[model samples]
Every structure is written in structure tokens, then in C-alpha cells.
Target: MASGKEKPLHSLIAGSTAGAVEAFVTYPAEFVKTRSQFGGQKESPFTIIRSTLASKGITGLYSGCTALVVGNAVKAGVRFVSYDHFKSMLADQQGKVSAPRSLLAGLGAGVMEAVFAVTPSETIKTKLIDDAKRPNPQYRGLVHGTISIVRKEGIRGIYRGLFPVVMRQGANSSVRFTTYTTLKQFVQGNARPGQTIPSSVTFGIGAIAGLVTVYTTMPLDVIKTRMQSLEARQLYRNSFHCAYRIFTEEGLFRFWAGTTPRLARLVMSGGIVFTIYEKIIAVIGGRE
Candidate 1:
């Protein structure tokens, strides 16, 4: 059996592996979502894919994949480690974690991930994705973009939309873990004794949880995307100002600019991440 001290490390490893797989599989959808959030006429996912292929070839669909893969892996590691730690702290003598406790644990995980991994990596990824459309892109790729941002705008530039990212990510994890844990419990509670719930069922539960997360936190996501994607930092004063401008100038639909692509990416990502995480934890004899 896995020792208590080793459980957190196992969670981190499992979560990173799951995240890397999710990033690779959903990168194309992420590419389109980033482009859509950068403020243009609403384009269908197919149109975005076609245009990206025609203009920049298949490479365009994975413009900042390097940063995404690494960032997501780190983010997932932090999330799972922090979440498991918090959940354990919240557990009762019976070792049962309540829904509210799970939600709070997820919130803590999200904030940790945003501060350590999401902000800089996402900023770089957004820059690279934005550059894919330029006739003469300023940043050649991920490495060049990172260097340029630091040289021109300083370290602060790398975390431009930290507030909104934190809000979005916090809400994302809170809703995801709460809903997923609740659903999984419901499933397991109903299962026959000695019968394990299948991975496919876990994937479906995770997908539903992801949809809940996307809708609940989409406005914050839109704000974060715009703030991070802008070449000019002076465009909006802060997160509230950015949201106000978008709402005033672009209307309500703008808040959900990339819903389709985001929905597609997140639904699959959630399923893949949770399935792999649970499977690995089971394999390692870690507490679920």
C-alpha cells in the first residue's frame, strides 16, 4: 500500500501525465478558442480550422503547443497535489470528504496553479496564437516570444492578466472537482458491491462537470483571454475595465466568444485528465 507521505507525489505525477495527454489531444481546439477570444467576427470552428490550415498550414493549429504542454502539465500537478492535500485536511474521521470541502479544495488548487503555472505560460501561448495571424509576426515562436516579452515589457508582462486568470481558474477547478466528485460518488453509491465503475463512466461524468465549469466561468475566461492577448497593455486598465468595455462595445454574446471551441476542448480535456488521474492513482494504490 502507498504510504501517506507518498500520496501527494503520486497525485502530482498522475495529474501531470493526464494533463500532457489532454493538451496534445485538444490543442487544435485550444488554438481556435484563443483566436476567437482575440476579438474578431464570430467564426465557426470549421472556418477557423480551414483558415488556419490555408494560411499557416497544420502548424498554425499548434502555434504554442510547447508552452501549453509544459504549462498544463505543471498546472495539473499543482492542482492535484494541492487538491488532495486540502481534501485530506477536510476529511472527517470516517475519511469522507463533503461536497463543500471538495469545492474549497479545488478553489485552493486553482489559485495555486494560476499563480505558479497558468499566468506566464498562457500569456506566452496567447501571444504565439495571436502571431499566427500576422503577416509578419513579431514573435517567431514560444522561445522568442518569451524572450521578447521579458525584454520589452519586463516580468510583469508575462503575467498581464493575473487577476482574471486566477478568478477563471479558481472557478474552473471549484466547479469541476465539486461536480465531478459528487457525480462519481453518486455512481459508485449505486454500483453493485465489488463492481468497479468503468473508466468510460468516469469520462462521461468529467465531461458533464466540464460543461458546468465552462458555462459558469465563461465571462471571466473571455476577459482573461482579451487582457492577455492584447499587444497594448494600456487598452484596458484592469480586469473589471476590460469586462466593462467588452460588454459595452461588443454586447453579451462577446462574453462567450469562444464557447464552441472552448466547450469542445474542455469537455474532452476534463474527461481525459480525470480518467487518467483516477486510473494512475488506482494503479499506485493512492487514495482516490
Candidate 2:
């Protein structure tokens, strides 16, 4: 068993492993989701994936995966570490966190990850995906592309869509973590003394949490993607304007343009991430 001193570090390792696996496995769905949001919902997810593969080969499906993989790893690590920290702080005398406190802790984790990891990496990933769609792509690769964006627009460019990203992530984690915790507790309650919940049950709980989170936060997800897009400078002024334009110009339904792909990705991602995270935590003998 990991010592109390080692628990947070073990969580970091477990969360990073889970996040990287989820990102790599589900990135194609993410690509389609972003494209649908940015380009509108004209094409089906299948069509988008097929077209991208036909035009750009397998690499097209993985265009901005580098940024996402790295970002997700760091983001998940930070999220788990901060979540544990905040949850511990908010825990009662019995070391149990209430639902509201769990939600708040998750919010804090999400905001911390968004500020430190998600914004910059997602900006780069969105720009790379947008660039790949152009007739003449500007970015050469992940490292070079990041350098180009930073040189051209500085920190602001890398941190584009910060507001929407923060909102989306905060909502996402709060809902997801709270739902998961509640469900896990329910399952644990059903079990006999000292019996741990099964991995399958944990996966199902995570999947349900993901579904709840996606519908609640889809609008913010669309807004965040658009705000981070390369043409965002020319398209709108800020996050508010961007949302306004999306509402007035593209219609209300446009906010859910990529729901299908996002749904697919997040469902699998939730299951995979939670399963792996728990497995690794078990290996390190850390509490969930």
C-alpha cells in the first residue's frame, strides 16, 4: 500500500496513464467533434472521418494528437492530484467528503487543470486541426506549430478560449466526479463488508457520468472549440460575441453540432479512464 505521503504521487502516475490511454484511443472521435463544431454540422461523423482519411491518410485522424495526448496526461494528473488535495481538505472527521464538497473539489481540480494544461494544449490542437484542413497548412509539426503560434500571438494565442474552456471543464469535472462518487458509494453500500466494487460497475458509473456531463456542457464545448480556432480572430471578438454569433447566425442547435462524436468519445473515454485509473490505484494501494 502506498503511504499517505505517496498517495497523491501515485494518483498522479495513475491519472496520467489513464489520460494518455484515453486520449490516444479516442482522439479520432475528438477530431470529428472539433471539426463538426468549427465547420458546422453538415457532415456526419462517419463522413468526416472517411473524408479526412481519404484526403490525408491515417495521420489526418491523428493530426493534433500530440498536443492532446500530452495535454490530457498533464491535465488528468493535475486534476487527480488537486482533486485529492481539495477533497481531503473538505473531508469530514471520518475522512468522507460530502456530495457538495466533492463537487467543489472537482471544480477546483478542473479549473486548475484548465489553467495549467488544457487551455494551451487545446489551443494548439485546435489550430493544428484547423490548419490541416487548409489548402496550404502553416504548421509543420507539433513542436514547430507550437513555436509558430507562440511567436505569432504570444501567450494569448496559446491560451485562446480560456474562459469557455474553464467553464466547460469546471462543469464537466464537477458533474462527472460528483455523479461518479455518488454512484460508487451507492454500489459500495450494496456490497458486503470489505468488498470492493467491480471494475465493470465502475466503468458503467463513469460512462453515465460522462453522458450527463456531455449534454450539460456541450454548448460550452462548442464555444470553446470555435474560440480556439485559427480564424477566431476574424470570426468574432470574444467568447460572448462568439456565442452570440453562434446563436444568431448558426441557430441554437448549432451548439450541439458535434454531440454524436463527443458522446462517443466521452463514453469510451470515461469508461477507459476510470477503469485504468482504478486499476493503477489498486496496484499502488491507494483509495479511490
Candidate 3:
């Protein structure tokens, strides 16, 4: 598949594989980071960890893992594959896709990833994890949460943070893909006719790009997290309703309430995701 002319399997394989590895490496941190977004009570990270372990066991640390995995797979796979496809198509017209082409490809990939990937899992996972506080309410598990949400909110209800997801992921992809391609070119220079670029180098560039995007989009990420969380239970009606309420009632600053946790998320899980994405590409014989 990586050999095929149109699909550009290398990119998809590399990106998706890297995403999987990254998810595994930083999953625990991710669990903590996500919970932090709930905020009102302000549970210390250590307390949160201890309590989670005591109540839910190590598995609670992986609350939304299935959602994260599926979401990342769609995101990385489409990003890599589509970036190549779009770039190559542009190349045919523009005498080789330039650095900016990579930028545009990144934008495209972001939108696509948001549409095809992030929205579904993000909303579902948040709802499942952030159930309205009840003394051990009805559903503590993902499956039960999902069923409850569907029965109560219906299909549209399941996808609360679509807007924020799209905005953040799109921005992230634009910066990441564009920077990755540009960095690769700058590093390569006018090397030998067909000399291969190093995988380590490629992934490093991706990491830098990803970090920038993640940090920049922090506000939106925080808002989305809250919208998807359980505290927002009595706060708003649904995702759209939640956003409107937060904007009007809480004010714009409310959107960024969980900035610290998000930053931690970016540095830990997000950074790992970018690095591992590169490693996965190398594992699958992918090229820059």
C-alpha cells in the first residue's frame, strides 16, 4: 500500500502506527490531564491518581482509551495518506509540491480528521468519563455511558464538541503537516540524487510542529473538554447548547479554564504522539 501511486500508504501507515505507540506510552498522563479539565473541585494530580486507583483500579487510567485509539488512527491515517495524495496531485500541476503545499495538505488533513475522526470519540469519551455527579450514578463504564447518552441526547447529542474539535484539529494539522514538510526540505538540502532522509529527523520535525499546534489551540481544547465533561451536566442542554452557555454565562475566559492541564497534556501525551508517529513510520519502511 505504501507503494501505491494514489493512496500513499507510507504516510498513513507511519502516522497511524506512530499514533498507536504514542497513545500507549502516554495514556496514563492523558487520563490525568483529561480529568483535570473538570476543575471546580481542583483535585490535585496525586489525589486524583490515588483516588482513581482506589476506586476504578489501573483500568480507570485508560477510561477513554478505545475512543482515543480509534480517533488517533483515523486522524493519523487520513493525515498521512491524504497529505501525500494531495501533495502529489499538486506536484503534477505545480512542478512538485512546495513547502506551502504541505501546509495546505495539513489543513485539509485536519478538517478531514475532524470530520472523520476526532468529533465522534471526543464527545463520547468525555460524556462517558464525565457523568453528572451522582452517588455512583447509573453508568461508570464507557458502554453504559454511551447507551445513556444516546437514549437521552440521541445521535446529535453524541457529538457535542464538533466545533471545537474541528477548530483545534484543523489548526493543529495545518501547522504540523506544513512544518513537517518544510523542515524535511530544509534539512535535506540538495543532497545526493536519491539519498534517503533520516526517520529520526523527520519525526523530530513532526514533534516540534505538533507541540506548536497543541499549545496554540489550548483554549479551544479546554472548552471542548468542558463541553464534553460531566459537570456541564446541569450547565447546558447539549454540545451546542453547552458552548453557547459557556460563552454567554461563563464568559470567554471560561473557555480556557483548564489551561494548565491542557498544557500538561500537550507536553506529555501530545509530544509523545508526535515522536512515536515518526517512529512508527520508520518501522513500516516509510519515507519523508
Candidate 4:
């Protein structure tokens, strides 16, 4: 069991492992969500899944899995490490953080991860998925796709939607961590300090957090996804333009086009990520 004292290295390792596992496990739903966002809101996930399977087989659902898996691992590592560091800094003498402090820490962590890991990775993943849908797909894999993007559009190509990504991630982590921390504290009431909650309880709390985060940030997510796609520049000028176009042309509900699959993915992702992270931390003798 963990001793409730977490180090940065422990957070990195545990978070990375948990993120990679979660990404791989829940990737199909992610694929569906992206396709739903890219194609149109009116198209149901079932129709997309059926069409993808019919046209490309099972592998069709995993077009950008490699990029996402790797990116999610690094992103999660950065998130956990930065969040822990910020939380520690903001913690009181007894090592307890208020909800407000936790939210701030999560925002900091989210921004860090967005700049370092998420932007490029998500850009590559979105591009790859977009490319695969083309009649003549260009890039082969993660390395080739990344190099091609950089060569064609320079480094900025891979950093598409940087602003929206940062915003989405910032809000995502802020809401998710704050919710998780507050709920975990509530659930652990009357328990001894540092006593690990049951796996089921942790999973439930994480799911709730993810649920809240998805709704709270779904618009930003939609905008980010659209902006990161290969043809975003041709379609829209900038992040503001993109948001305006989506709102004025596509309607307000368009901003939440891919909520279902995203919700499913996050629900499972939240449970799996927290459960695995805590388990790994416990085995490694670190917890917070």
C-alpha cells in the first residue's frame, strides 16, 4: 500500500502506465468521437462504426491509435507530475489542499501538459485520422506522418489548435482534478488519514469527474478537434474564427457533436486511469 507521500518520479511512471492503458482500451470510442466530430453531428456513432468496419475492417477504428497511446502516456505523466508539484506547493502545512488550490494546480498541470505533449500529439493523431479517411491516404505511421506534417507545414502544422488545446486541457484538468479531489475527500470522510479508498469507490469518483469534465468542456473539445484537423486552415482562419464559424454556420449544438462516444470513452477512461494509477502508485509505495 502507498504511504501517501508521492514523488514526481512515481507520479510520472504511474500516470504514464495508467494513461497508456486507458488510451489503448478506450481508443475505439475515441476514434468514433473524432469521426463524428470531423464528419458531422447528424451522423450517429453506430452509422460511423458500421461504415468504418465495412470499408476498412477492424483496423479502421484504430487509425491514430499509436499517436494517441504514446501522446496520452506522456500527457498523463506531465499532468500528474505537474499537478502533484503544484498541489504540494499549494498545500497547507499539514499537506492538505483546499478545493480552490486544487483547481489552480490542475489548471497549471493541464496547461503544462497541453504545451509539452498534447498539442503535437493530438495534431498528429487528428491529421492521421483525417488522412486515413481520404481516398488516397498519404502518411504511413506515426513517424512518417509527423515528419510529413513538419516538412509540409513546418513545425506549426504539428502544433495546430495550440490555443484551443491549451484552453480545453486547462479547463479539463481544472474541473476533473477539483471534482475528483473534493469527492474523494467526501467519500473518505471519517476514515483514517492516508487510508486508501476501495478500488470501486475510486473508479466511481473518477467516472463522475470525467462526466462533469466532458460536459463542461465539450465545446472547447469540438473546436479543438476541428482546428487540429488537416483542412482546418483552409476551412477556418483561427481559433476565434473556427469557433465563430462552428457557432454561426453549424449551430450551437454543433459544438457538442461528438459527445456520446467521447462520454463513453471518458467514463471508461476515468475509471481505468484512476484505478490503474492508484494501483500502480500503491505498488510503488507512493500515494497522495
| Higher-ranked by TM-score: 3 or 4 | 4
Over 4 Å off in model 2, which ranges? Answer: 1-6
Native-referenced Cα lDDT, model 1: 0.87
Q: Kindly report which residue stretches of model 4 are placed more than 4 angstroms away from their true locations once superposed.
A: 1-3, 39-41, 192-195
lDDT of 2 by residue, 1-288 (tens): 111322788889999999999999999999999888885448888888899999999999999999999999999999889888888888778666778998998999999999999999999999999999888899988999999999999989999999999998999889888888778877777888888778888889989988988999999999999999988999989999999999999899999989999999998888888889888998877764
Query: What's the C-alpha lDDT at position 225 in model 1?
Result: 86
TM-score (C-alpha, index-matched) for candidate 2: 0.96
| Backbone clashes counted, model 4 | 0
In terms of lDDT, model 2 sits at 0.89
Local error of candidate 4 at 238, Å? 0.7
Clashes of 1: 0
Clashing pairs in 1: none
Give per-residue CA lDDT, model 4, range 1-288, as digits (tens).
122457889999999999999999999999989888883446898998998899889999999999999999999999999998898889888777789999999999999999999999999999999888888899998999999999999999989999999999999999999998888877777578867689998899899999999999999999999999988988989989998988888889988888999999998888899889888887887764
Per-residue C-alpha lDDT of model 3 across residues 207-256, encoded as one tens digit per residue: 56656766577667776787677556667565577667667766776666
Each candidate's number of clashing pairs is 0, 0, 2, 0
Ranked by lDDT, the better of candidates 1 and 2 is 2
Overall lDDT per candidate, in order of appearance: 0.87, 0.89, 0.66, 0.89
Ordered from best to worst lDDT, the candidate numbers read 4, 2, 1, 3
